[model samples]
Target chain A: MAEPSWSNALEALADNKFVLGDQLVDVGISAPELASALAAVAMAQGELGHARHLYHWSHELQGISKEIRAESGKALSVLRHHENWIELMVSLLAVNVAARVLLERLRQLNEAMVVSKTAKMLVEMAEHITFAGEWCRRFRAETGAIPGLFQAALSRQSDAICAWLRAVDAEIGGGSDMDMANAFVREMEMVCGPVTVRHPA
Target chain B: MSTSVEYRAYAVFARSQRGGPLYQIGFVEAFSDALAKTYANLTYDEENWFELCVVPLDELRWVIEPQGVSAKGESGRGGAIVEQRAGSAG
Candidate 1:
């Protein structure tokens, strides 16, 4: 059988092929294409080799310079996450700390309810407080404030949460029956009032 | 590869000077939520003495730009801020 033609082999393969200069490079089958690709690979390899040598020498020089070493260390911290290093870590930590505060508030609320003997009638209230704190913390950490509860109760998810928080706040405020909720809110306000104001949502 | 990247989101908190409500100041973006918190501290830890909190992106019901709106209504310096997205706006 005759040798397969370049066109036939090229058609059989999935890769694309093109020619450069006087070379009939066949990316899929022709020698010219292979040659060009090989040349490209060689050129890239040479560039990488040069880069590696430069990097080694620069690193050695940096090792000798205390300032450069310190600067590089600082640079590593600064550029770890594409220069958004501080931004990302700090915001999340803020949210986490806030969440902890909220949880502490809930724990106190639960204690208040149990002490007031209102746990049976107001279990949902306690649950709501806990859920809101958790949800707020998670949401803040994940998407920031723009789309979170600050932005109109993201779908029904936010509505449900707001409703729950409002209801709890109301119960804590003592609508009809005199419950421990009132005292709870007052105390929370006393403790978290300064910090809570910072939250936009 | 030079793939284009941009700040997608931010974490911000507000500080209340007097006995007033706290407002959002600025934000920082990162690959994850945890990183955003770290950024929040650096940005707001000084100057205003902010009490920062992690507000979920979705739960943030209100957004007021201090620069865009004048904080000079009946509510005084804290009142003129505009709510960009009062999530619970009925």
Candidate 2:
């Protein structure tokens, strides 16, 4: 049996995906191209599917029958709506990637179901990340759009993400907050381009 | 004013088994190679293809054209051969 913290974290993560999925479904219509719009809708469906997949795992493994509800009022601040595609892309990376990282930490338990189910979920998650990352980088590359939006989005979400990490990391045996932050930075630099992650001195 | 999306067509191919010839399952139009892939995956998701790929319509060099091959899916008599198939199919 898994710990309560793990179960609760699973529930929370599932809800987070739900929120991101909901937001994406709304913004997906505004995508610049038909292909991106389709991808957005597909990705939204994928997010909702992932949430259900996790909830199923929790129900089966931990017997937590919590509903997969995504009330935006309680969502992570970083996962909120944005006016531009750049910020949307950032939020996608911020939340979706964070969810994957958290799952990685949870998968450390090495439960048979956890490993197999999350492994499948992880593959799809990586593709979503790649899609968001590529577009985010593209937004940065194109001129006549706002500058520093990526940096701003990353900075704005730092505190909430850090707090969330601290709250859940110890229970799941994940690493320090800096480790999570660095992981995000490393991914940003990799997926986008050179990026400066502003954190505490 | 409506935002205009500039894009190019990509021919999507997939194979059902290893060592088999790839079949032209469909085509998708997108602004970039990456986005084209997402479109391809979503559009051609009916099967568990063993392999899949997308090629820019401009990049393919034709040594010869197949009979009944239309450059357009509907407009050209060989419909869907439009280079990304184009024009009226007769």
Candidate 3:
């Protein structure tokens, strides 16, 4: 197999961050509570900051202008799968968890450039994961069950999520979709026990 | 659909560089000490801080008034004295 281009990987990561950040800001405006809205805005800003850094680094390495990179198409299907607030929160948690996994994998590659950038991104992601997990746990505690909407959104977005993982895996030359899915499921279970998906038969 | 999670308030302190004194930068809300630390660092990491720490608001005690005042206290300019209290310690 040919070695994956780091520039391509960075560009893809930057695009994902930009799209996710935009969705987060939208969600922030629609969030029901003040605290959640503030947190969503903060997280959205963090995501945009990550995108800016990643894009700048990629441009430094690949000589691509920020405008061109920002204009490039992004794979945002998974983020767009959430239709409601609950679904949006769950989707953010799932996506961030999956992204963290890929980031860790990239960091483990031992490449100086990749490791440094991934490490910084991971620092911001750590707080994001904490916030998301706490919110999910709070939702589960209050409702006593993972809402059907969240479950449905997760099931609907699973394919896109897997595709994202696969793409990252291909870029990093390691990890599998199955492993990433299993890990994500385990994280979801930890946050909200055994999320049930009611599939239409 | 409520997304407000209860979090304890924590006062954040940071040292700008090595051997510098840790001063109050800002505050963050989190459930645990670990989360508080992470939130403090992530939220206020715009500057190159050498170290950061958080203390729960409940952990610190406050002195209501350092200088006692009378109801109709006189000031040097012959005006009523206005008492002011500091914010929470943490």
Candidate 4:
């Protein structure tokens, strides 16, 4: 197979298409798990691209060196070597952030979709909402807006609420609704400190 | 505005104070290390207990995470705890 261009890899991941066997063989990955591995790598690559874009924006905003400025646009360079864990992790964080932002855009696009209609659905959606806010504020800060610590704290709390949602999703399949709700409340306390989750009458 | 090569001071930490975590704290936009250091120190000193560090823009650790604040005191509970405890301890 021909060498994978950056664009092809990103498009594949975004579309959720499995990487072909030829590509996997070229990379020396086994045949059976090639699809999963390819998906992971493609997703990782896409994430790096998004991170690179954000990092470049921040660098431009902050007036860093031209050399540094250039590197910000090439997040894929950070992941060239599997051993580059720091850059890889950074790239992953950026992707996680982009996922969140996309989720929010989806929600805003369809305002009628209230989360609380189903506990499981709500938790899943809430994670996306909270994560989006966190990434946006960080993006702003990195780009020189200088958000206060309190604002950052608000982002963290939003994450906590998202965590509570995940727990509810897990419990929806089997546990009693009341117990699931109670567990979610407990998780919320762990993430954001103590808080009440009173339901409307 | 100037394109001078400079370091961005950061206060790196894990999400839950765990042994192994990503570099959550991000870049400082100041020009000089001293200015960056000062900014990092003033801002992160209390939160990460002043474990401030510096890196160039190219070297910055960029593991950003989403977080939120709660009045219940989970996120930045330090400010509340320290102020309350300081009076009693002193």
> Per-residue lDDT for B5-63 in model 4, tens only?
34344443424354544555754554444434434443444454423465655564559
lDDT of residue A190 for candidate 4: 41
Residue pairs clashing in model 3 are: none
Work out the TM-score per prediction. Answer: 0.21, 0.79, 0.68, 0.20
The regions of model 2 sitting more than 4 angstroms off are A59-62, A66-74, A171-175, A198-201, B1-8, B17-21, B66-90
TM-score for candidate 4 (chain B): 0.38
How do all the candidates rank in terms of DockQ, highest first? Answer: 2, 3, 1, 4
**Share of reference contacts kept by candidate 2:** 0.39
**TM-score for the second chain in candidate 3?**
0.59
Candidate 2 lDDT tens digits, A1-201:
455657666766777778778778888778876777778788889888987876776566675466645442346766766776666777777677777777776667777866877887888888788788777766666555344666677566655665666567655664665665566556656776765544556
Q: Specify the highest-DockQ model's number.
A: 2
Per-residue accuracy of model 4 over A33-144 as CA lDDT, tens digit each: 2322333343334334443443433344345534322332222222233222222222233223333332332344343422221234234324322322333333334423
Residue A155 CA displacement from its true place in model 1, Å: 46
Error of 2 at B74 (Å): 18
Displacement of the residue B33 alpha carbon in candidate 4, Å: 52
Task: List residue ranges in candidate 4 displaced over 4 A.
Answer: A1-32, A68-201, B1-90
- Give i-RMS (Å) per prediction: 21.4, 3.8, 3.9, 17.1
Docking class of 3: incorrect
Off by over 4 Å in 3: A5-10, A32-35, A53-66, A69-71, A81-85, A144-146, A167-177, A187-201, B1-7, B25-39, B42-46, B61-90
Tens-place lDDT digits, model 1, residues A1-201: 111221121111101001111111122122122322333233223323322332333444334322211112211121122112122222222222222232343446445532343233133223223322322333344444333332222222222222333443444442433222233334333422312221114
| Candidate number that wins on DockQ, 1 or 4 | 1
The clash count of every prediction, one per candidate, is: 45, 21, 0, 11
Lowest summed lDDT window (length 10), candidate 1 chain A: A12-21
